[model samples]
Target: MQPLLIYNTLSHQKELFKPLTPDHVGMYVCGPTVYGDGHLGHARPAITFDVVFRYLRHIGYKVRYVRNITDVGHLEHDADEGEDKIAKKARLEQLEPMEVAQYYTNRYHAAMDALNVLRPSIEPHASGHILEQIELVQKIIDAGYAYVSNGSVYFDVRKYQEDTKKYGCLSGRVIDEMLSTTRELDGQEEKHFSGDFALWKKAAPEHIMRWNSPWSVGFPGWHTECTAMGTKYLGETFDIHGGGMDLMFPHHESEIAQQTAVCGHGPCKYWMHNNMITINGQKMGKSLGNFITLDEFFTGKHELLDQAYTPMTIRFFILQAHYRSTVDFSNEALIAAEKGYARLMQAYKTLGRLQPSKTSSVDVKEYRQKCYDAMNDDFNTPIVISHLFDMAKVINTVNDKKATLTQADIDELKGVMDTFVFEIMGLRDEASSDNTALIDGLMKMILDIRATAKANKDWATSDKIRDELGTLGVTVKDGKDGATYEL
Candidate 1:
């Protein structure tokens, strides 16, 4: 019943989401650099923006979500001085830079696909758009917002600050304060100020990924590709721009300045940032050596893991918190999430087998609104998940004959589950019942043999079957209704 309210990183407040166009929405999310294997840190933004993409479409907006892949021009230390992350990796592995990029990009895509993150409408690669980046660099130069120094192009932050006081707005940074406290940049002699950032970096002779640009034989700056590619795909001004909260300053901030400097206005109507994921109250990152890769989580290869977690369990764990809130990782927390997810999923399957009563006992209609309300409240997925659990309880009560459901209520409940569980939450049944069909059929025949044993008063054979299954952690429940088993 309420409109979606998005927290704008620009304004630092929650505002109603009104698309620029009546029926279409354009959104740009900063994607992976793909210099290494995808980690749990990488899963957050992909899943976060993925829910946004899905929810927008579910609400009937024709959405074009452009998420760019930084296949080139990303430095090792998040600074202009260091070698490209991909290039550095390539050097260590004795491979071409493009080869390294392609390998990791494939790995990233596979990880994302496992997480059920829908592919964006346009996934532009920086290496594929060197011309557009160069053109944008030249535009900034002509606009007097950038200057050529020592064969490299640097943004004139001091000069640009004088024209428009827009640089510090997104990051809440003061230009003078930044200059006073800023650390030494890579090309200190060439830059007018320490705060100045590279638009294009002049490559050294040893560098292998150099391209001929107006400035020098070099690659585009780390920040240049987003401005160029975002504008190229999503237009100079679009509806929303999103990424991790880590990109707020410098990355997203520079994006604003570049877009405003060249295009004369801000890039997007809303700036959304999802918060980080932490491990043991500390940030998870490759540099920190505390980070766990998604592969490690799925395979339980890391020493910190208790057991392997399915992709859906990981998804449920992330969505258990609000997007703006930081999610902490722990084996205990994850185990609880896994069990909770399994319970909810099992209830969903049970919903199909329920026999409707003559009268309805639960308010299924109210659930749809509550789930939507939770999601509409800045995409508060935790509350939506709680409501789903409530539905699960209802399903259990109905099955127990403690409550009742009409046929219409049954269908409505199923709709609510499908919408909140599958559609909005972007969750799928990870362990499909059909996936274990053959095993289920085998188990059924075995249990039928045990049943025959019981009918024949063969206590030894029944006990043998039960004890053998118990050793394998398979649980068999006997009741007057029927016999059931699970593994």
Candidate 2:
């Protein structure tokens, strides 16, 4: 099998993967803030890194994946002037902050589960690790990289830059460029430098979620939580850290600064960033107002969607595009993906029922190797899926008696489908999961009776069974293999 090569955002190039420990891999991904329902924007990262997690494990690596829930420390906006996202939601709903967090967190998990995303090994919450965050802030201050002004603590970017040479390495922005691009904040006198961000902000009189720290009763900075949580779980340096490409600046950059300030080294060996999902050629973001929620997509309740798309359809649609590419959402694109996914899945089901021949006519082993080659190259799921469709053509040919497959060839084909279609792609038979067995069994029995009626030239009884069964959410069809029924 070809070795896996992943694009590293830090190096700005695709590099061959080699775990820090021999066969062990550690990955950290920034998860949701739990302030509201998960939107389509949230699904990209969840599914993108989910593939990474699955593929790593598939390659015989013992992987430890840490994705955190930001129950605290996420300000409503980039500016420090807004209310806490969770706290504001709590007040509006007349619930505690934790209550709001729990509700949204469960909602997020349900959405992910529906998408078939595996839960992370450790899902640390920022609110639950106050002491660790406080200690980190203290370490930064003690190291002279941060200072407390009034009751708030801010990272001294000037001092940090003077001490550390590659301050803006991840963002590729110079301090002067940031100073020029960033809009001036109203209350900026406390910060020593224009780019310096809050390590802790002093809580207002009506602030809902405040915690006692060395500086004052304030919450941790947005970037500090990931650093503390990541280091706590994955150690000072781990294998990979992944998030949306939008987080490269400020969020991931600040994480690099904070981790280096305390631990004297960067947190992760590789940084992977998945590109955004676009709608109408524009990036789908919360601030853009073009964002659609996952619920809206699943229900087809959005104005832009033509019809409801099943969870598997959405997953297949996403996998159709390379994760690094910006996939534009449209009815046409989704329809195409839906039909393509159905074709592949139908062919997969047909593979099991195909009769084996004494002689093989195709090179099944070579085709299987090609599938692995596609996946090994940066987990190119789209290319791998395309190859699966090609194999599907072969399977269909064999099933139609236009070609042939030996017993060994049939076993190889089954193994290929099982590995790539189910194991690596993480797709399950969605139609088979919901009362399909019982429905299929009952339909088969009914179809048998209908076949006997047809054999006896009893047109009335056969048509009655077919028409009644069709009315009751089942369709019976007469085929070469007797009759088959479906709902």
The root-mean-square deviation over C-alpha atoms between each candidate and the true structure, in angstroms, is 10.0, 9.5
lDDT (Cα, tens digit) per residue for candidate 1, span 77-103: 335475766777788999989998898
Query: Per-residue CA lDDT of candidate 2, range 1-487, in tens?
Result: 7788888888888889998999999999999989889987788889989988988898799999999999984853447455777777788889999988998999999889989999999999999988998989999998889999878888888888888876788878889988898777754787788788888888877678999987788888888899999999999999999998888888898899998888888899899888888887887776777778888888998887889887788888888888888888888888888898888888888988989889999888887788778877877899999889889999999999999999899889889988888888878778778786786677778788888899999999999998998888577777787887765
Q: Which residue pairs show collisions in model 1?
A: none
Clashes in predicted model 2:
0
**What's the CA RMSD of model 1 in angstroms?**
10.0
Q: Kindly provide the TM-score of model 1 when superposed on the true structure, using C-alpha atoms.
A: 0.88
Per model, state how many residue pairs clash: 0, 0
Give the least accurate 10-residue stretch of model 1, judged by summed lDDT.
Answer: 73-82
Poorest 10 consecutive residues by lDDT, candidate 2 = 73-82
Best by TM-score: 1
